[model samples]
Target: MLLLGLAACGGPPAAIIGVDGVSTRAVDVPGTHLLPIYVATSRAASDNPHLLFSGERSDDVSYARLVVSVPPDRPVGEVTRASTLPPDPRRHFVVVAAQVFGSEADFVSSLNRDLMERPAPRRHVLLFVHGFNTDFPSAVTRTAQFAYDSGYPGIPLLFSWPSRGRTIDYVYDMNSALQSRDSLLATADALKESKAVAVDILAHSMGNLLVVESMRQMALLGRFATADRIGSIMLAAPDIDIDLFRKQLAPLPVGDPPIFVMTSANDRALALSRSIAGGVSRAGNTDPEKLAELGVNAVDVTRVTQGDRLQHSTFAQAPEVVQLIGRYLGNDGNLAEDNDDNPIEGVRNVLFEVTLLPARIVGGGRVVVVNE
Candidate 1:
């Protein structure tokens, strides 16, 4: 596939920006006018600014370090959908910047300067694993978009695999992601083994499967102790076979925090996915007996409304789902508020809240709790 990227630029350049009480380095990238704010961080300005958590920016060939520090006085949600961010005195929910480091050598050379120069005790590091039919540039832009939208105050990293941005490439893209799972592990392991900052995962669609499989792989092997770095995992409309997932992922190895799986029966996209694959995808369909057995806390999304498709991508489409993701990531985990008026199966509920009844979770009521 022809990749849309930036032409080769020289050595990395550095600039200074102040948000809150700290000063952070502004690393340059391909398109400057696209995103208003580049990065915000907790690393002290006195520290080295070259070293930073890096990523390939939007298939553009340029790489960057994403940091956000929300201003203490401002509400982050405002800057989310706005065209121009980094407004004066708005309390930096995020400060961001990137640099063009052509090779792994250049990326490493600028690492220390980037990390040490920002405010210490950084907020969060969100690694977004985008689903099918997306390009690297699309992934990076969306990562910034969600970070801005969700008002997340942390460095947003995009773990992009080569995807052909077309539905026909589904099989190829799926294989590509699976094949690159080890590379993802290696990258994440580097972070897990580093002193950079806190880490979390927000994976959508097929990306969710890859994220889970990667973590599960790392956890099972006792490899990177950093797998525990995952504060929370947001699986949005994951397209995986329920039966296969159970057979493969049940009894996952113990890690630091619990993993959250969000699904919806109203996801029309998943319906298409079902038609294409001819099996029950894990998003809305799973064995009721296996919730706890798989060590996952599932949430039914049919009651929620998200995007244009009213589709499988509910995690990003709906405001409530986004809020729930924030709550989950923020450690504001409250089971009671997990529903309010909505009764579920297990906190462990099996009901998938589908618009139609499929005799499973679709026939809503309380999901039958199993071995729990």
Candidate 2:
């Protein structure tokens, strides 16, 4: 119903790289920002040159390096794309450069080379896993937008699974995510073994399921020995069942790369998912206190009103929320405590105030109360 309608709004245009006699080298625009996004995908190659990748699954993981140009003068949280072909770099989010690696060794070598060029503190890596109904171009653009908005100096990487990018293909997308778990783990391992100082993770919606499941596997395999190299693990609007999420976290040791979950009770997409899952509660709509009891930091954004019509993307679409995340990352996986120099200090103050109050159920949704 509502979820289906929201999904029908469509995604970004097909990525035009090395097509229409366009150069596959970096395109420089005076006011625009260029972001390099390293990619590890489990999707098969597409015949269409504009797409480069398709929704079909591949037996082995593929690697690529893409440079995206972010339009200047746009809103903080928006990633605008050109509606027509031969994208305008000055005004639209377009791929300015692309390189497909023929071997895993080549990709690692290139990534490490880039890491060495950055200052020691900026040698970290940020890996983003997109949720259901996402395509290759959309994921690439989203990663660039997040890196640019957050002012993150670290390398940005994308682990894209074979999502059909259709709202009606929920079951297929879920299976695809599960199918790509091994590939995600391999990608993470590559990052951990690279010359980078640390690897931070950000996952949205159903992507949380993939992340958690892969982490559980990592724990079982005793891969947390080098967990010191892992930074924040932020889950935004997870669509997993509450009980399943608990089981997944049970195996992990305490404080292994400190986990943060962003929840919003008003998320209509999760509400619909809950109904589809036989009324099982989705983790994204759970109370913060309940999540805290599970040894994870939970930030509730139900009070924030900025996002798309469905309210599922508030973590990225809300200016205040995105700024808060950017500040958290900039602070090296920890949010500053009462810093006046922080631009989003007012939002942080409000969040702290609400967190102290007890939450109560209101008309089947959770809401915080004030001591009157």
Candidate 3:
């Protein structure tokens, strides 16, 4: 009868939503906005191939859900497309409760409900963007896990860009990532404009470039009312050229929403990214010399290594990243504070600021203690 969930927005109208007679709705809350999701399938376009996860049901397909128009109960316009129902509706259109996310439109709306209705006003909304060579499923689950690891599983939003699921699809995926830039910007603008939502973006690898480029466009177009709402940007294994990042910073002129860059010298993928992308230095190669010059908060992640590269993608691949992310979520470290401050220079570990313990200056071997 009535499926009440989080939200409704863009794409196509008449979404099948995996179920036979499904509709979308938009829900709002204090810390996040719940966007509507519909589970449907689109005809595979030439450039766009279908994405598959081995563990998922065979019929599930990638679809976008939205609430583009509203007219009370008059069958208003929807944000996404309407495709034929899949064989398995539950698997095709399972509702997720995450940020500006849309596997199901009500996912965000539902998260809002859980936060304000069930719990309290949600404090943080961390948007996780996955990088190169990842399928849609890998991106979603890992992001959810990342939030779980950080102990903020109830916060709203997960942004997984459309990265082709493959290793050799590097250039193609890079270009594909480039294509999605505009949409990400649109989403960012929408979130910023939403009076009820406070947004933070965590973009990894190619997704970092995507979010940056989107922000740059917003900055150039003077979409700062939109830009300013961006709470913080945490880039892990950023896949952009160092020069490109500076240029991007120049245009956007970071002020409110600070930028935090996490790198790892041990990251072979970034080394390869540097080589293949033609001298485009990545955050993975960030050093004390270049970070401040580039106007980024460089957090070295070399010492925080854990999982297999997650398709050569860093950031959420390690458990420590989750802790670091948790610290950032608390909104303690400002990018201005981290500028030129290489916390890792002396020890060479994954460096980020935490409020729990005071700075430990290495005075001597075992004599090191917190600054008194």
Question: Each candidate: what lDDT?
Answer: 0.49, 0.77, 0.47
Q: Rank order by lDDT, top first?
A: 2, 1, 3
Note the residue pairs that clash in candidate 2.
none
TM-score of structure candidate 1:
0.62
**Leading candidate by lDDT:** 2
Query: What are the RMSD figures for all models against the true structure?
Result: 11.3, 5.0, 13.8
Q: Residue by residue across 1-372, what tens digits does model 1's lDDT show?
A: 122111111211222222222233222222121233222211112232432322211222223454443333222122222123322223323334445345444543444344555464444566788887764334544565456445454455677666655666778777866766776775664455444456767888888777777766865786635445556666666777777666545445432355556666666666767777876566544433344346566665555554535456566644444545654554423322343332221111112232322212321112322110
**Which residue runs does candidate 3 get wrong by more than 4 Å?**
1-115, 118-123, 193-196, 225-228, 309-314, 332-372
What TM value does model 3 have? 0.61
Off by over 4 Å in 2: 10-12, 18-28, 226-228, 337-372
Off by over 4 Å in 1: 1-98, 102-121, 224-228, 254-256, 284-293, 332-372
> 1 or 3: which has the higher lDDT?
1
Give lDDT tens digits, candidate 2, residues 1-372: 655666667555676654321433225456776778999999999998678789889889999998887776777667777677776666678886789999888899999999999877778788899998888888888888877776666888999999988888899999999999899988876776689887888899999999999999888888764445877678989999999999998888755566778888889999999999999888888877687777777777887777777788876777666766666664556643333443321121123222224544333223332121
**Candidate No. with top TM-score:** 2
